[model samples]
Target: MEPHLPTTIQISAPQHAANNPYRVIEGEEVLSVAFREFVLTAVAAGWKEPEVALTLADIADDYVMALARRAAAN
Candidate 1:
């Protein structure tokens, strides 16, 4: 099956910021929104930009590898 990336994404946030903090991220927006959040949060905690980027790339590579392994196994 081909991957589908939506041009537009809809995110419904919790009514209260203190609770129900997680929102569902779909399609390519997950790459943008989630990646941005991770980078910003990591940088805020004093992580260097290059290291953060490399970490994200490594995570993405691992995810794709896992998916490929799953498909091959099936």
Candidate 2:
């Protein structure tokens, strides 16, 4: 199998820190770029079909959201 290349998602820090404390501290850390990387890696590793890639991407999206929520709660 070929190597899986990682992908990055750049999430900039949101403004209005007083309104969103999590955004002020965690910032882009709340967004799971690693999850996006995992999905891309899976796609590069023989999972070339569109449906499979989309499924992985969805999973990655869920992961990112979950991470953000967790970060916010803390």
Candidate 3:
């Protein structure tokens, strides 16, 4: 019998801030997928820039929900 294998994932942020002043803050999320796919999605979705500049609390709920959905799928 074969045992189930766990999925290994990692997320990271930029080491420093972006140079763009329009970006109140800059960071990144690293997913374990094909580099091309990741870059394409980020570029197409325009998630590379901050959509809104607000406190972390403002987006915490939505972020948590997103994390939950991703976790559930895995």
Q: Highest TM-score among the candidates is held by which one?
A: 1
lDDT of 3 at 65: 94
Quote each prediction's TM-score: 0.59, 0.37, 0.25
Poorly placed runs, candidate 2 (over 4 Å):
1-48
Which ten residues in a row are the worst by lDDT in model 2?
27-36
How would you encode candidate 1's per-residue C-alpha lDDT over 9-42 as one tens digit per residue? 3344444444433432233455577567767767
What digit string (tens of lDDT, one per residue) describes model 2 on residues 1-74?
A: 55545556556555656577676556555455645565566666766667676887798799999999999999
By lDDT, highest first, what's the ranking? 2, 1, 3
Residue 64 of model 3, lDDT score: 96
Per-residue lDDT over 49-69 for candidate 3, one digit per residue giving the tens place of the 0 to 100 score: 243223333676789999999
Clashing pairs in 3: none
What are the Cα lDDT values of the candidates? Answer: 0.67, 0.67, 0.49
